[model samples]
Target chain A: MNRDAPCQDEWSILVVEDHPATRQFMKLRLRKAGYRVMAAGDGREALEILKHHFCPLVITDWMMPEMDGLDLCRAIRQESWEGYVYIILITAKDSQEDIVRGLEAGADDYLSKPVHPAELLARLQTGRRILELERTLKERNQEIARLSITDPLTGIYNRRYLNDTLTVEVRRALRYKRPLGLLLCDLDHFKRINDTYGHNVGDLVLKEFAGWLQGSIRGGIDWLARYGGEEFVLVLPETDLAGSFDLAERLRRLVAEKVIATPAGDITITASFGIASFTPGGPENHPAPETLLNEADQFMYQAKKSGRNRVVGPTGNQ
Target chain B: MDIENTARNLGIGRDELLEVLEIFLEASVADLEALTEAVAAEDRSRAGAAAHSLKGAALNLGLTEVADLARTLEMAAKDGVLLGAEGQLKDLREKLQDLTQAIQA
Candidate 1:
């Protein structure tokens, strides 16, 4: 509701008219009506102002020396901008055919000239309303895109994001002849904890574990994602097998020592880690993402078989 | 030139309208000069453009007499007819002079 309010004071309207008197009158009335105003002698000057400054609303006269209102509208529509520009064309030619021609040339609205102050203000209000609606819709679309990639419970990247981004990371590493490492980790006996303390406590422990893992990684070089229930994957760029193994061992110990204090009580947990890495040797050695994931899964299974709370990498157990 | 009535009709304050009128007078003078030269040279396009500019500004300020005279000149020039354009130009000059005196008074 606050966004819907007429916040005219925050807006600047560009007035383009070759006639100095009309331009002055429009500027005075617009400023008096709580709008900041900028004036240009013609459409050419208007474009120059728009290049350096952002003005969402424009009122222009149909006839001017350098460029006219109809051409200005067409020029504005041809370019790409961060936001929409609302244009109103002022014409003395009041014929219906002329109105249609103006609209066809990309004018959003048209005003008959000898512009009455009240009518000018009213038309500008309509332009503001349309621009506000566009802004709200743009923001909503960005939010929706963000929500699609985020995990609801842990607030981390979800499996879909992992699938989408991991391939890109792998391709980049291979193309650049760099190393890429992956660590797949699962909490030891997670189902038993869920059955013993109830699913609520289990969910809390998972969220806390995710937070810890996220914080421990290199901020931009490494990323963590919720692979599935109680399992997470960390992708480390430019990290070799040894480096990933070292990180895995450190994380395994950290998980074993951490005491997650939940509403139920303090609970200690252990986790198993399997590390896999790709060092680009040649085209023949390039592996698909599924192969890398499967290799990590097998190493993790070996870690679980030998003992819980341990790290298994390509070389052996650690 | 009833400044109060004109200002009220245009939905603006008298002071603000007067400020605009000051600018209008200066700009219209230049336009009048341009129209005079264009009519002398029989350049219909230039004359039409100058008259068009004057008409737009005069109409905005509620100066109906000036606006009506400007419209007649503009239409004649647009039709490529410069006949009697001198008389219209003379009438326009007198009206502007009267408005200037009124403002000074």
Candidate 2:
């Protein structure tokens, strides 16, 4: 809300008037008010300026050669733009009918000619407030979207996000004929640890593990998510079976070596991993995501059955 | 006529007031010349446009006499009635020249 900052104060206004003297007067007045100003002789000139420079505020005279203020306002409203443009029309037509005409032509506000300096500036302040409100609303909407996709407890992406993004990744891999890898990891004897250490300490351990897995994965290229209670899913794009195995081994070693400092004290933990990869159009190509996940889930149970802390894949325990 | 009061009401300093007055004088003279030519050629639309433009500048600068006369001429042209338009234009022209000289002084 503090528009005194440079970024917030950089809103520019365009003034379009065929009369050079009036154009200069408006430009100087607006510039004095700490607004960046651009001027054009008529609507055509204003459109030319708009093609390259994005001016969010426009003040135009009603009558001019070639194109008038109403024509300019209509043209602006027709085009699609990233930011909203606020337009004010200044004209000698002071009747109620004239005001209605201007508003219908897409002018946000109207001013009679012989414009009072104070009144003009006040209208512009209103325009600034509206633009600021729009900016704040857009930012808040984006934050809400991000919050919906993230896990509240672990601060990692939630299962809902994993479900949506994994399908898109699989389709992309198929299109490019690249391999897509999925790693399913479950904490070893997690329920027993929770019963021994209490739920608070158990929660701390889960949070710590999530942070560690997020840090260990490749930034931007790989993503990890909290699949459910004690299970997590890692998505590795463009990775083959060999690459998945190397990553699984590295993750297993990292988990075995790391110690989590909780309120109860230092606790070392290990997790079992199951890595499954889908090579596009291979002899055993996975036709659906559910089947691929079932294969990984089966392999993960195999790892748990063989021992507690190890990785198992299609070839068996490794 | 109340030039200082007009400047104070506009919230502009004396230098800005002088600059605005100077600009209005120059633009109004050219517009009045165009109005004269349009009237002589019996081009009512051009005459109306020129008169309307002059009226706008005069009102902004607080040239009430010039603005009133220009407005009358503009309305006459718009109505397609040349009657009394020449008289109104002559008076508007005289007021503009006098105002220009006063500003220069």
Candidate 3:
């Protein structure tokens, strides 16, 4: 009846007490407290149960029929399971030596025996609270990790996250020897827009352009990010240069034609793109990761120089 | 006419507020020209369209006091009653002009 029980929809608790009377009493108590209870008389049975289902909390008694609770705690800790299990050890063996031994064997907390209903409830309460706190921390950590990688303005992944993740992706591509294409794109005449219309209008144009990109891109493996101001990158997994070029041309034409309805009437904007992929014995063969970035970046500049609003790729030239 | 004061009254930045007001100003001048020509020619629909456009812009900028008069003029002009409608239209025009001028200042 403790508040920590959380209405017992999902959370399971395992009671590993050897004596029939003790095990039965604990089973009754845990079921009443809204836990899906699994009874194990020994460490081996508990280990078998754990191999199949993950119990976030485990309550064990020190002395058991075969393979004692200390051994069980040790075996559980050594497993490959990434999640935490709050192990509360109950025992009539209340000596300091035995209690310390239980904790050293990886029991999270210890409960003394003649376990009063109130004391037992309190221990389970602690177990539930600790599990909930840990779950919240894990979720918050993921959210913070997600935010750290995202661009503040465009709401796309930033350069830091790109560098961190792309390197791993590249290494993975190399390990499996798969094709990975990178597209570098820059907004045309962005400086002119900023100078001519003011920064606010420039910001509006960028947001509109980003919206256009978001509307067009829809693939599970596509990795999109704001590479820098007026620049964006898309990493296409298992994609070759030809596919990347087709996508780039579509995006280029889309941007060129998309009319932004600003307060100053509809403003038309265009972008230049550069595509590069891992090609065997090509112009950028055996190039470093930065070299690929540099090659893509250079080609983007070439698009800018050779007249904007087009997609350019490595033509096997330096 | 001060559009900046209109913007301030609407809780938008003075510059953005000014730009929207200028848009309304440009729209209003064209509408006014059409309304005057429509009234002279006894064209109710044209007068109504001009008044309707002006009313919408004024209401968007939270100029309810100005919008109410414009709406009255718009309805009267729709029913082919341009006589007293001109009086209220002139008053609404004065208010917009004053507001735009204050905004510019």
Q: For candidate 1, give the lDDT.
A: 0.89
Over 4 Å off, model 2:
A1-10, B1-4
- TM-scores, all candidates, are 0.93, 0.89, 0.67
Q: List the residue pairs that clash in candidate 2.
A: none
Model 2 over residues A1-318: C-alpha lDDT tens digits? Answer: 112222347779999988766776777777766789999999999989988898989999999899999999999999976688999999999899989989999999999878887788888888888988988998999999999999999989999999899888888888889998899999998998799999998998899888888998899999988998989999999898888888888888899999998878899999999888888778766446666677788889989988878998876667
Best by DockQ: 1
Residues B24-82 of candidate 1 have per-residue lDDT tens digits of 99998899999999999999999999999999988877888999999999999999888
Report the lDDT tens digits of candidate 1 across residue range A1-318.
001234535898899999888898888777767788999998999999988887999998999888988899999999887799999999899999999999999999999877777777778889988999999999999998988999999999999999999999999998999999999999999999899999999999999999989989999889999999998999999999989998998898888899999888899999999888898894437877777788888899898999879999888888
Worst 10 residues of 2 chain B by lDDT: B6-15
**Fnat (0 to 1) per candidate:** 0.74, 0.33, 0.00
What stretches of model 3 exceed 4 Å from their correct place? A1-10, A173-176, A192-201, A214-218, A261-266, A316-318, B1-105
Backbone clashes in model 3: 12
| Candidate 1, RMSD to the unseen true structure | 2.9
How do the residues B9-100 of candidate 3 rate in per-residue lDDT, one tens digit apiece? 44345665556566666667777788778777768888886776566545545567766887787888767678766677678778768766
Off by over 4 Å in 1: A1-9, A282-284, B8-14
